[model samples]
Target: MRGSTNRNTRRVRGVLGAAIVVCAVTTALPGAASADPAGVARTAGAEVGTGVGVERVSVAPDGTQSDGGSTGGAITTDGRRIVFSSSATNIAPGNAAGSERVYLRDEPSGQLKSVGSYPIASPVISGDGEYAAYWVLLFRDTKVKLAQWTAGSSIGLNCDALNCSQPSLSGDGRYVANVATIGRPSTSQRIDVWDWHANTKQELAWFDHTAPSRPSISGDGRFVAYQNGRTKDVFLWDRDHGSTSGPIEGAAKEATLVQISEDGSKLVYLSGTDTYVHDVSTGTAHLVPNVKGLAIDPTGNHLLYAPNDTAGPSLKLRDLTAGTDEIVSNQPASAGVDAVSAGGRDVVFQSTADDIVPGDTNGKSDVFVRRFS
Candidate 1:
């Protein structure tokens, strides 16, 4: 996910907000992957490793900054906490000017907690607001970092990644789905799930040609949707049943998988200029209603995206359930949706257009959140 990450989600409040900046994972077409649905034989379990301990640095950055850009990633259930990446020095504690870093905006406590270095991809927040998960280039390879807010401690995942792609966590931070390299000096990789509750990591599927996109996990950690690293086709894996379903025929090349629903009933994957929504309840894989669609709510009932053939990027939201589309903004520059709040009531995106918000005269890209009732 870190090869080159394009970020999405969360809006700016006071310009230089001390929010966590994360790169959004993107994908392209790949070839066939060798998968074994019956390969629970390769499952390896080990005690969860808690690597070196580091205390979080604190800073207070409100609406006053941005010598560089910042991209927002996750928001807590209550929306009081935010995490994003930024290059500006003032918003993050102990960060050098222009050095990229991740910060958490705790609006309730009025402080910013540093998550650490620039992540390989955007870090995700648990719905319970107790934890944050993301990966970084630690030394030889990328490593996952789990930040605990309640305990005020940050632990680097001592486990070697199945692959360095982004990791997805459950709302409670109980399960994490990631693709990791299976053996050394070979391109083979497998989808690995780290269970925090059981303190173990399991191999779901071992295959080759896996891409760098994040293997999205269901909110409850029951299902996982991922793109074939080689084929660029999407696939769904069911944990309880120990089965795999996909390479989702016709998924095309290039995509970002939204977090799967807890029930595995709603799924959305936004590809370049394509929005693919698989509605199990409707029995249809609806495609082609929006361009460069950004975020999909947890329930998959709403989708935020850009309009095709429009002068400016007209950010629009589609009510997937009702099949209605409404425009959110028409900023004259490029924009992208970052994170959607719980139940899809709110969204934050980054944009270079300065006229959308009052007094946004800085002429640089800024993050903004839009709410829906």
Candidate 2:
């Protein structure tokens, strides 16, 4: 349980006040889509190198935080902004009641701003750079609510009484997907996808006993991938056809974790102790030989994973298409890999290096960005 933290069941109710405050304020300028026609090309070009450059953006005890004792953050397409949660302030130690709020820092401007005062979790930015989404817990009734903000406005996406978690926005910022549990542990849980433009809601699927976590939408909004069951199996729900595929044929029953490609054509999941990639288009599964921690690049052609050695995990990048792989970074023997963000020409990950504060051996992780060469 060293790196694991239980999900927050205790809900907080400061969202309504936060919403009112956000609404009363004047809207900021709309975020313009990248004017560069070659934005995608620029990102793609970076992946071909050894590994993207790594930069330490946040460190524990340094004002870094996450929701409910857990880690969560966002990395925009352009890598200019990184929004993350930290418990460095406000909350009392060992008590989850202090509330985890969302905060954003612009890398270029060095301006860190709080996105209102609500207890927000799992912040995700839209593909178009125009919107952000997260879950806010209102303490009054312990109810979890879905909330969103565009450049010009903020609104709640409706959760009358049900508890909702894991909000994912589509590339175009038109849809948000999340899991809504009606009865908690005793009752079944259902995954729902909401169409923002249409202002409608529809159930995506139902689970008998297991609740889905970490629901991810593809860049094009064609597929959603989530972890399912005690088996730790990963499943994909196709959006266009309204069908489910995999527990991917050969994926290990109890040790799998899935992440879809940005294009939604491939599914990457951990199978047993090894990681495997499945072609959603062809249903073929291939072992990403010798790679662990398996984080797929945005293009789906490359994968980033930790190696088998415990001498602190190094970031390994593999070109799935060409069947080649390489270690992008070899940190000191004391560092361990945490998470990664693979954009166009850059890849970033969290690692525990030796210089971390002593006695803070909670395995606190720090962010590192690499230029992939």
Candidate 3:
């Protein structure tokens, strides 16, 4: 069965240029290989749910009727582990209750484990696949709490001020970055980081009106990138330097999503018709025209984005150092590349087009992964 691609929203802008199509990464047949550019050796796209036991799931925020299940802000660097929230019981047992539950799929082992129950959202997983952080509404307390799932147990995070949401974890799973309203009388939302392994907490930034929007921590836990809600500009917090860098000079004031590279060197964001990748060292923005939905690989070298102006739109990848652009997928403009892996090797996205994969009969959007070999 097929699913839908609906999540948080972002603004769209101008048209993209004609894509430079290299040969396909790999042949459609299994075990087939094809020549490709330097950074990406070979590439192939396949359905993520195929042969993985994911069925058509109906999900909504609070028991309303929606088309597909939620990825729950869940993706990993290895492309081998996927965590999502589904309304289907068949994904794993104990989900038979018909409520939304989080499930983790270890692709290499073909093992599916139910992380927990009780209304979860915004799940972020560690690169090593050992830890997960999500928000769960505790009915008894009548407040939202951030829950940490590691090694099959659920641990409640300290959101004592009342509400907590948008949990992001470092690649190593040692540190978690989140937004919570803390202080007596629940003063305001603040961005905080917790070292789960060390059992320590550090406050990165505080906002009086609203939480720093979409706070993202680097894989190494050295930097936190977020949009300063007050200024509507991008800011990067360096743990080692103990300094915050932004309202980034060239960044758009309306920029909503800010993604920091694994090494804490580059920040990518979309502003109007252009996508800008800012160099942390130089504070310079490398502008890519007519692009949206961008992701920077862990190395900070490769960038993947969806062009808004393609005649038949698809995903494209550009090697920053090499200055080479390769068409990631040419499926229609309606199809999008949702997430890219750490090394720019694996990309996961959703498509309503049936031709994205063979035997997609259900006519619902399905998650597909492209692997660069």
Best-to-worst order by lDDT is 3, 1, 2
Candidate 2 versus truth, CA RMSD in Å, comes to 9.9
- Candidates in order, TM-scores: namely 0.74, 0.68, 0.73
> How many residue pairs clash in all the candidates, one count each?
31, 27, 3
Question: Which tens-of-lDDT digit does each residue in 138-238 have in candidate 1?
Answer: 56676677766655455554445433556777778777776666454546666667775555666666556445645777778878777655545566776
The TM-score obtained by model 2 is 0.68
lDDT of the candidates, in the order given: 0.56, 0.51, 0.57
Model 1 spans > 4 angstroms off: 1-62, 161-163, 182-186, 250-259, 270-273, 281-283, 332-338, 361-363
Candidate 2 lDDT over 1-373, as tens digits, reads 1111112222221222123334212212112111021112122212212223343444322233222332354555555555555443422233245445554545543334445345555466665445666666665323333333334345565643357777776766676767767664437565666665666665655665544566777877778777665546666777677676656643435545546766777777765568888788888878765556445655577677777765753666677777775555566321111123443344444445533222223354444345443
lDDT of 2: 0.51
Error of 2 at 175 (Å): 1.6
Evaluated at residue 250, the lDDT of candidate 1 is 48
